[model samples]
Target: MSRRIKGLVEFEDDNGAVVRYLRHPHGGGLVSPAAHAHEGAWLAETSYVEAGAVVHDGARVGPGSWVDVDVVVGARAVVGSNVHLGAGTRVGSGARVGTGARVGERVSIEPRATVTADQVVPDGATVGGSGTGRRSGYGRAA
Candidate 1:
């Protein structure tokens, strides 16, 4: 059975394990207790930070953003509204994702990288990692 205590949910997992998740006060999003959301980090009510996720200090996750399990949102990173960060995605510090951006799984958004709004980042693509900022064949939505 699931229980709520002071905005924290104790969910009974299918594996017979009960886990704890804290609901964001501002956005009502679910953040796993195992996840690390810095005190300075901001999460919209409509966002979800799954288990093993790390939202560093100063990072901002907009509304409707889903930070899947094991995702790493670096310090000062900005995840725009309605953004979907696939599992294992690493958003380097200072990176900025525009609204409606869909980042594929295992995608690495290097530090200081800027993803335009409504952009679709394919799975396993590397953005702004050393060599070239953005990989070819990726751009804003039509």
Candidate 2:
């Protein structure tokens, strides 16, 4: 019988890393108390931000999105609905991930990069950069 803490949700990755999150005051999303979500950041209902995740100011986290441990969503970045940002991933400022994208761990989405909808980003992938069109993250970063 595991005694779960009130208002706390915990998830364990395949690597045995356990992440936890608390309820967000504004949108009923799950945001870890240890995580940093700016007051200006908009967290959609049903989103989950794990411990150690940082969502900077002006960022909009879409519904059903998951920000894993140690992930940083830069200022003004827009994470699409149902997007999954794995551990150690970094989304640069002004970057945008399209809806339903599943990004693996340790991924880096550069500033102003635009990931297409429903795209699958592999682990350790580097995406977005200057001159990147809407198809950024569809392939390796130039």
Candidate 3:
């Protein structure tokens, strides 16, 4: 059985819909009504996870991070402080987004990809491969 870590409060969404969110443990973060975060996920205080976002077990979202709509922060992924993950962004399992990284809208980081601390990824960019590198495009090169 899961216990209530915090209370629920209502807020108005951009579309004028009243959305409710659950406050995280120790006043860490706010989990949206439409978002799902595993118990092991560590959301620091001041972070806001938007609707449809899923934070898997062992993932840690630092303070002030903004996880936009439909974003998926994979298991064990570490999102640094103040990171802005745009809508539809996917931080693959085991990926690490460095502090203050500005990930543009719809960016997809492949599994195990590491966006070096403070890296900036443009909108629609795809970061992949077996090592740390920044490639500007939609997909990996053939």
Candidate 4:
């Protein structure tokens, strides 16, 4: 599917960097420059990936979403609008995270699996099944 934000989101220009808006409105302003994502990643309006969160190459975080501490959005992964990725979650390469998905802490996203909107993957849980159950699409070796 084509990549684009799909909800009520806000974009703020803080200095030269683009900052996404966290719903809680931290740092003493609705639009603060310090809320900016690291390395000049393209942050959608009202979609906030907090500091220390790494969104790598071509990863798109949709509008109205919040990616919390130390989360890693892998290359080409698509995070949908209004979705919340808890701390230490890993969205694998090419995985599609649907809108309103609530992923729990330390979850693993298998590559190429489609996470339907509003699906909740509990902490340390695995969603997709490997053809042989030996390895999920992109999850751990367990």
Candidate 5:
């Protein structure tokens, strides 16, 4: 696939090294100048992403998917294709958020946690597990 950079900017990395931030033409969200997205991923124009975030190939972020700082979305993870992700929510790497899943505001999905395909996660809920039992609140500290 041919990918072209639609948005480009310079930012300082964690090591203080200057780096280039690139966004694909498919991304319309408020992606930070420090964030990077693949060509096939779709980030809505209203969504926001902080620095150190990445949306991989074929993943779709709905109009309001709030990708927090350092969040990493796995390849082909369908996020809010039909539903919207609440503001300020964070999705960890290797976590697959199914289509039409309503992830409430401020929800945090731990790394490797699977929200299942088309599952609904309520607001302020913490989800984590091995993607086998559909566990919730397993890695959250209350």
Candidate 6:
């Protein structure tokens, strides 16, 4: 069965849709459900996801960041304030995208991969050592 891990931020009503979280000791915090879009196939309105984070379509985030879902940010990779996704852009599990480094189309980042700190990933482009070799896997780095 699928279960959620502790410390990670996830939606309580969105079928366990994962959101961003603050690292323990560093500042583990909670997701804020404010000024957000609670409909559609993505997170909506006034959210601010941080670098290396992700969200997928159909994933509902009230006012937080999506960091995990298959441990990858897909379609609606939603993000919120101060949230980090690490890597692994497989946010297809009802993502809620926000600010910060979002997962691009056909892109796959490694788990716990830091997508923050000026890491720019284009559409259909892979960033870390995951998925198939090459930048996007479907082809070579352009």
| Candidate 6, 16-71: lDDT as tens digits | 65544322221232323322222243433323334444333344433344443224
Model 2 weakest lDDT span, ten residues long: 132-141
Candidate 6, 25: how far from true, in Å?
25
The models' CA-based lDDT, in order, is 0.84, 0.84, 0.82, 0.64, 0.64, 0.38
lDDT of 3 by residue, 9-37 (tens): 66666777776678866436888878988
Misplaced by over 4 Å in model 2 are: 1-20, 131-134, 137-142
* Candidate 2 structure quality by residue, lDDT tens digits, 65-131: 9999999999999999999998999999989999999998888998888877898898888986675
TM-score of each: 0.79, 0.80, 0.80, 0.64, 0.51, 0.29
lDDT of 5 at 33: 71
Candidate 1 vs 6: which has more TM-score: 1
Candidate 4 residue-wise lDDT, 81-107, digit = tens? 899999888777777788998988888
By TM-score, the better pick of 3 and 4 is 3
Model 3 residue pairs with clashes: 28-45
TM-score of model 4 vs. true structure: 0.64
Worst 10 residues of 5 by lDDT: 132-141
Candidate 4: regions farther than 4 A off: 1-41, 129-142
State how far residue 139 of model 4 sits from its true place (Å).
Answer: 11
lDDT per residue (tens digit) for residues 54-136 in model 5: 77876767765666666667665556545555555666655667665766666777756767556767767788755633545
The residue ranges of model 5 lying beyond 4 angstroms of the native Cα positions read: 1-24, 81-137
Clashing residue pairs in all predictions, respectively, total 2, 0, 1, 2, 0, 34
